[model samples]
Target: MSLLTVRNLNVNFAQRQQPIEALLDINFSIEPGERLAIVGESGAGKSLLGAAITQLLPKPGYIASGSVTLRGKELTQLSPKQWQEVRGQRIAMIFQDLMMTLNPVLSIGAQMVEAIRSHTRIGYKDARKMAIEKLAQVRIASPSQRFEQYPHELSGGMRQRVIIAIVLLLRPELIIADEPTTALDVTIQAEILQLLKEVCESHGVALIFISHDFGVVARISERTLVMYAGKIVEQGATLEIINDPQHPYTQGLLNALPQMALPGQRLNQITGNMPSPSERPSGCAFHPRCRYATERCSQEIPSFINTDVSIAACILLEELVSHEEEPDV
Candidate 1:
């Protein structure tokens, strides 16, 4: 059975006029010890999907419909108390901002021990020992000494390591890392990615790595979901999508990668900006910005179609398949 399954998950922002759909018909699954990346631009609902899975959506945002299941258990049906039991014990999230994720007033040991105690009835001393060990496991130097320091005292990379350590305290089955290395320098980013991948592999943990950069996604995840506006535009193996993208949006993203640029040339970029939920265009939300969009694209919503390389939601792919299937004269 899949470790995690999200079926038609819809998230909406409550508004007096009408509910704004933040996520639409999101569906995907993850297997045990597998790593999947949700890739898209800002407001593409990558983080929102993460929040929906963890039941941590921001104020006014809620799951309008659909289900989030973990190990055959339906999370959407869980009550507040039940959710508390499932959160740290089964699923944990690593936010991008370390400062916001870590408490300024609490020492690293204090925060970790508190988390451990909240999920399990361990003694403070035992929790502290476990916390320190976890810190060391993430390769933080001087773990025991660093445990007593506050978040402000650590560097960005070190703080991220602490966050990972805290998430590992509960030995969660799945970790949702929401751009955890975005704030760090390039070298630190690579280190954290390597550490996160190694930690998950060592622990036999599944991961949902949310990122906008294809480069990072390629490094950390085996599969990739390309999200646009509020829907998945493409889904397939990471290397497949990176090497041979079927959807225009996915192709545009890979094309924009630095490695794709010629030396001294300006980096490529996709034309236009992502549309907001409230301002999403009819038919295909991405139609307005899609260079390959046709008149039909603006009038009819595209459905996902399977290609040799990936599953993509675009009429161009559908038409290509149709033409190929037609009998020749």
Candidate 2:
């Protein structure tokens, strides 16, 4: 059975003028020990999806439709107290901003002790020992001394590591990591990703890693979901999507990636900005920027078409592939 299942989920925010649809019919599932990555541009609802799963959406934003189930229990219907029990215990999260997640005034040891004690009834001494062990697990140097330091005293990478350590100490069944390495250097980012992958693998923890960087997603995820304007446009095994993207939007994003070519070669870029929530076009949200868009594409939404290892919400895949394989015109 899937560890976490999100079906036909929709999230909306109320505004003075109109209701902003933040997520529309989002659907996906993560199997036990599976590492899934949700990749998209900014405003693609990646972070919003994470918040929805954790039941942490801000006021005025609410789940308008569908269900979120973790271990066969419906999360949406859970009471506040039930949510508290499920959140840090069964489903922990490593938020996007480490500094925001950490308490600036509290020592790392204090926060870690609290997290460890929150779910399990443990004495301060036992919790402190677990905290130190977790800090070492995330590769924090001089874990003993570092545990006594405040968030401000630690470097950016160290702080991120600490946040990760806390989540791992919980040993939750599922973890929703929202851009966990956003604030770290490239080298540190690699280390963090590696640590997360190792932990999830060893503990059979399901991971939903959300990020806008395809390279980062490709590195740590076995499966990938490409989201656009709050909906999934393409999804499949990471290798399949990366090597053979079918959706026009996915193709455009892959094209926009910087290449290690000659200095004079121009880099590819996707033209056109994403539409605002209030001004989202009818039919396919990506129609305006899609190169293969037809008259029908602008008038009707395309259904997801399965392609063995991948699924794409595009009307022109077959034609596009046929044309690509054709000889010179």
Candidate 3:
């Protein structure tokens, strides 16, 4: 059985006039120890999807029609108390901002001990020991001294590592990490990604890694879901999506990636900006910005059509295939 399954998950918020759908019919499943990455530009609902899965949607946001299931148990039906039991113990989330997740006044030891006591019946001393071990697991030097320091005393990377340590300490079956390395430097980002991969592989943890950086997602994720304007436009193995993107939005995103070029060579960029959430286009949310969009694309939403290793929502798939069939340009 899949460890986590989210089907038709819709997160809506009440606006001045009507309810704005932040996420529209999101669907995916993760088997045990599987790593799935959700990649898209900002406001593409990647973070919102993570929040929805963990039942931590922001104020005025609620799940409208859908189900989030873990081990075949429906999470949407869980009461606040039941959700408390499930949140940190069975499912943990690593927020993008470590400072928001950590308490400024509490020492690392105190915070971790509290977390352990909340989930288990261990004594404070035992919990402290476990906390120290977890800090060490994340490769924090002088775990004992670091545990006694407050959040402000550590570096950004160190604070992030502490958050990760706490999340993995419980060994939750499913972890939702929302751009956990966004604030760190490139070297630290690589290290953190490696650590996350190792922890999930060794503990059978299903990970939903949410980020906008395709390069980071491509490095660690086996499967990639390309989201746009609150919907998934393309999904496939990481390599396939990077090498043979079917959707115009996906192609544009790839084209914008920084490439190794000769001196003075200008980098390509995706033209135009993403539409505001309230002003999303009618038929296809991306139609306004899609280079290959046609009348059909602007009038009718395309169904997700399977293409062997990938699935894409694009009316121009046939045209794309036919063009590829012709001789090299």
Candidate 4:
């Protein structure tokens, strides 16, 4: 059985005027110990997907129609009380901003111990020992000394590592990381990625890494899902998508990477900003910015088509498939 399955997931915002769809027809499955990456622009509904899965959506946002099953247990149907039992223990989340995630007043050890004891029957002393061990596991030197330090006392990278250690305290089956390395320096980001990859593998934990950078996820995830304007435009093996992206948006993203640029040449850029949910264009949401878009693209939403290399939702791919299948005279 899949570790997690999300089918026909739709997230909507309740507005006084009318309900606005934030996520539409989202579908995917993650296997046990597998790592998946959700990559897209800032407004592509990446973080919203994570929030919906974890039942942490902000006010006015709610799952409208869909099912989220984790290990055969339906998560969307769980009550707040039931969710408390599952969260942290079964599914932990590591956010991008460590300062916001870590309490400024509480010492690292206090928070870790509280989290451990909240989900388990362990006493304070045992929880403290476990927390220190986790801190050490994340490669924090002098774990005991760092345990007493407040959030402000640690660097950004250290705080992120602490967050990872806390996420490990319960040995969660899955970890939803939302751009955990975005705020760190390049070197620190690389180190954190490697550490995260290793830790998840060693713990046998599935990971859903959310990020806007395709390059960043290349080193961590085995599969990639490309989202755009609240829809999944493409999905396939990580290396396959990186080497031969089937969707225009995915191609544009890979092109914009710094590594894709030649020596002394300006990096390629995808023109136009992502559309807002409230003002999303008609038909294929990406048609407005898609260079290959035709009049038909603006008039009809494209359903996902098998592209051999990757599954993608685009009319161009459909045309290509049809053309290739036609026999020559």
Every model's TM-score: 0.98, 0.94, 0.94, 0.98
Residue by residue across 1-329, what tens digits does model 3's lDDT show?
98899999989997788999889988989888899999999999999998888888898999999999999999999999999889888899998888899999999999999999988999988999999999998899999999999999999889988998999778788888999999999998998899899888878888889998887888789899999989998988889889888788888888777763345777666677777678889898888887777898888888887786599988787556667779976
Tell me each candidate's RMSD, in Å, in order. 1.0, 3.1, 3.0, 1.0
Candidate 4 or 3, higher TM-score: 4
Better candidate number, 2 or 4, judged by lDDT: 4
Give one digit per residue, the lDDT tens place, for model 2 in 1-329: 78899999999998898789989999999899999999989988889999999889999999999999987889999999989889877899888777789999899999999988878899999999999998998889999999999999988888888987898887889888999898788898998899889988988988999998887887899999999988998999998988888888988878777762356888677778877777788888888987778888888887888776598888786555567779996
lDDT of 4 by residue, 131-159 (tens): 99999999999999999999999999999
Question: Which 10 residues in a row give candidate 1 its minimum summed lDDT?
Answer: 282-291
How much lDDT does each candidate structure score? 0.93, 0.88, 0.88, 0.94
Worst 10 residues of 4 by lDDT: 301-310
Per model, state how many residue pairs clash. Answer: 0, 0, 0, 0
Candidates sorted by TM-score, descending order? 4, 1, 3, 2
Error of 1 at 72 (Å): 1.2
Off by over 4 Å in 3: 260-263, 318-329
Stretches of candidate 2 off by over 4 Å are 16-18, 260-266, 318-329
Q: Which has the higher lDDT value, candidate number 3 or candidate number 4?
A: 4
